[model samples]
Target: MTGVTQQAKSSKDRILEAAVAMTGENLGAGLSVRAVAARAGVSTGSLRHHFPTQRALQEAVLTAIYDLVIPDDHVIHDTSLPARDRLIACLRLVLAPAAPGKPSREAWSTVYERFIAPEPTEELRATYLATAREGLRRVEYWLSVLVEEGALAAGDNTRRARFLNTVVGGLSVERAMPGEASVLEAETEVLGMAVDAVLASREPGE
Candidate 1:
């Protein structure tokens, strides 16, 4: 019984990994069941057995993508560091590269494509919205932590989180453009400015 459960979990992980790997390049439009099944080394029938529909596969993939855990040594979780610095770390985290050509912007890029496509399917829209919302929730969680630590001024954390997500979204779009419209330095500078604007001034003359 345990062996069967382990095999099932492994198969699911492989499917999700294949979906993530194939998400870029075409903004997820290429993530058809046959393609994913081929990538995962499984039969289409096998994939369908696990996920009854394409929508189910998409939801599972997006969920798994967001569920990709940051390692314990991630900078944001370094509580010994200042909140402003930690927040900047988050900006860097989001701005990092996804594919060599694309940078770490595929999350927003795919969602944008889905949003503007000739009439997105409800499942596509819902999956992307949930993925994006989860990102904002993380920002809010970080802000609340900083607020508790007295590093950020207490306010409507939800709004603050949305604002941060907006900034990242803008950067993501820029990075996704044809040319090098958004450079890494510019991304860091804007994020630094935004973080400074939000953090509570603790020093006498900061």
Candidate 2:
């Protein structure tokens, strides 16, 4: 039983890895079961045993995207660092480049591309949207840390978090678009300004 379980897990991991790799190449280019199975070097039957269907593969791929993009440590837990600094680090880590062909920029590429692709069923669209909402919540938990430590200025933390995420989302779209002329300097400057703007004011300026 243990051996079988381990093999099943290994096969599942391969499928997820293959999907993630495909996502990197063209963002939502080729993610169908047949394509994924070929990339994973597994039979369609074996792939179905793990993923069951297309939506399952997409959800798993979304999970994989977040896992790669989100920071790997609990730096927010350290009492030594100021909440503001920790919060900034958290956001930066999510957007910062991890390595060549890794998750940082790739996450946005996948999102925009996925949105453009047509889904065959409403169920898949709903599942995709749910996964996206899950992606946005990644930083909300760390923002709460800022609130608890009293480092964050008094205001609606949820709105502030969403606002920052929206900024990041827009930036991601810009970066993902073709022929956008990669401008790391300008991009980083804008992101820094956005973070600073959030921390500098509690007015929730309309």
Candidate 3:
């Protein structure tokens, strides 16, 4: 029983990893069960045993990507660091270049591309919206903490959180789009301005 359980876990992990790789290669393409099975070095039958269906596999892969992009260990609430600095660190983590061989940027690009599609399949749409909401929830939580810490004003934290999230999302889109050097530079400057504006809005007492 233990051996079987271990093997099943390993197989599932392989499927998730392969799905991420395929998503990275083509942000707009849907991952087929056969392609994922092939990448995982397993037969379709074996893959089905773990995932049941393509939707199940896709959701699992999407959830796995979310975990990687915002790992639990990330400092979402570090009171020692000023709120602005902590927020900046959070932004940097999301925007930083992927590790040498990892496909972090590509995975993020794929997620955003899927989220903004005009009409995704029901399952895909649900997955994208859920992922976006989860991100927003986390940002809101952190923003509230900052407000409680007196780093920000007592005004509407919800609106502020949404604004910051929108800015970040827009910047991510710009970075992913085909662009010339000037365009990329403009996107970077815009992100900087967004952050500066947020920081500048702090109350005098804060």
Candidate 4:
């Protein structure tokens, strides 16, 4: 039984690795059951036995990507740093890939062509949503950590995480276009404002 369990775990790992490799070429859209099975060198039945559905496969791949992209060693773990700084560093990781100038524009173009200009298929939608949810989860984890550390005021972290993500998303979109001089300064100011808003003391309500 242990041997069978180990074998199943290995198979699942191989499938996830193959799917992650394919994401490098076409984001997460390369995770089709047939395509991933071929890439992983597994039979369709075997793939189905592990993933059951394409959505499941996509979610697993996205989670794997999240683990690779944001490991436990990330800045968020550095309690030596100020909690606000650590949170900002964590948020910046999301923006790092979309560099300024041509690269950022090209990345946005790919996003548009693949998921925006055309009506996305169910699989595409699922993949995109899975990616977004993973991102949100990461941000929420950051907020939760700060709260636990007594660095951040405890309130509705879900709302705070959502607000922070929206700010990051808007900044990502802005990167795709031309910006004034001192773009870095502008971004930093905006990020600081966002961090302050979430950290501010809660007021009395009706």
Candidate 5:
């Protein structure tokens, strides 16, 4: 690659890395252009050149996060594993950032403070929606892979993905709250049930 192109790519990478770090720290609330530029050690003009709008920057950062956060393609693609087991493993990956007890509670508290407790600004609302959309998209992608393997019946997986996401979301909340001592076992059972529903689902005509 030419020197100038290489330099531009490096600058963009730095900006994206900074934004992802800030999002992890503050849950997308402090992702202002100035703050991201400062964290990236790039001038505001440079940041803007790479990402023209705050929404654009936020979306790009979120895409990068999906890449970083969900690298479980191995689990999804391992055909030897039971289809239900693979799906459950993929869903479990979503809960890694918020394990049970104090850490999980703290993660939920952050969500409450940023998006729920306050009347969110337009930008915050957009960010949260983008996050939810990306999550559903990710689950859909996992289901598609299983369908390709003939492990899951082929159909439009939008509804299936939503159901699985709801189950995972509820599990996350359960982890944050006081729960029975058999939390892990119960979690596994719930996930299996969710996976079974998706796997057994048939299209309306069928």
Candidate 6:
């Protein structure tokens, strides 16, 4: 029984990995079960064994992507750092590339573009929104913690989370456009301005 459980878990992981890879290539389209199964080198029956419906598979994919893009490590909950600093750290992690090059940035832009599209099926929309809501929830959760720590004011954390998400969404769209080095710099500058504006909006003396 234990072995069966481990095998099932491994299969689920493979399906999710395959979905991520496929989504990277075709972000705007829904990934087919057969395609994902093929990518994972598993039979369709095997894929269905783990995810009975396309919605299930797609939700799993979004969940996996969200986990990779915004892992727990990105949310700083340290009590030592001032609330403002922690908020900045969280914003930087959400906006800036995790490395020197902008591969992660490009990848995330692709994901965001997919999210904003109208072609996705209802299942996809539900899955996408749920994943996005979870991401916002994490931001709000951290912000609330900071508020309790006397770092942020006692205001609407929900609205603040939505605002931050909008900022990231707009930045991702700008970054997704085809541009030269100068254009990249402009995009970066715009993102910096957005972050600065949000940080500046914090109330006096929290």
lDDT string for model 1 (102-126, tens) is: 5445655555566665477765566
| Predicted model with the maximum TM-score | 5
| Tens digit of per-residue lDDT, candidate 2, span 74-170 | 7778778766566666766665653223344576555555665566356556655756665666666766666677766667766777888887766
Listed per model in order, the count of residue pairs whose N, CA or C atoms clash below 3 Å is 3, 0, 0, 0, 0, 0
**Model 2: lDDT of residue 136:** 65
Model 6: residues with Cα > 4 Å off, grouped in runs: 1-9, 43-49, 72-75, 98-131, 144-156, 171-206
How much is the lDDT of residue 5 in candidate 5? 49
Local lDDT at 141 for model 6? 79
**How well does candidate 2 match the true structure in TM-score terms?**
0.57
Highest lDDT model number: 5
List residue ranges in candidate 4 displaced over 4 A.
Answer: 1-9, 28-30, 201-206
Candidate 4 per-residue lDDT, tens place, 5-82, comes to 424557777788888999868883647778887888788898999899877877788778877776644588899899
TM-score of 6: 0.59
For all candidates in order, the CA lDDT equals 0.69, 0.68, 0.67, 0.81, 0.88, 0.68
TM, every model: 0.62, 0.57, 0.54, 0.86, 0.88, 0.59
Pairing residues by index, what is the TM-score of model 5?
A: 0.88
| CA RMSD (A), model 3 | 7.1
Selected candidate, larger lDDT, 2 vs 5 = 5
Which lDDT tens digits does candidate 3 get at residues 1-206? 34544246587778888888886676456778898889888888988999897667766766677567765334657666666667766765656544212344575555656666457777566656655666676666667776777776666556666788898776665555555547546645665676667656754566
- Stretches off by above 4 angstroms in model 5 are 1-9, 28-30, 43-45
Q: Which runs of model 1 end up more than 4 angstroms from their true locations?
A: 1-5, 8-63, 69-73, 99-113, 178-182, 200-206
Q: Give the better candidate number (1 or 5) by TM-score.
A: 5
Candidate 5 lDDT for residue 50 = 95
lDDT, candidate 3, at 67: 65
Give the range where candidate 2 is weakest over 10 consecutive residues by summed lDDT: 96-105
Q: How many backbone clashes does candidate 2 have?
A: 0
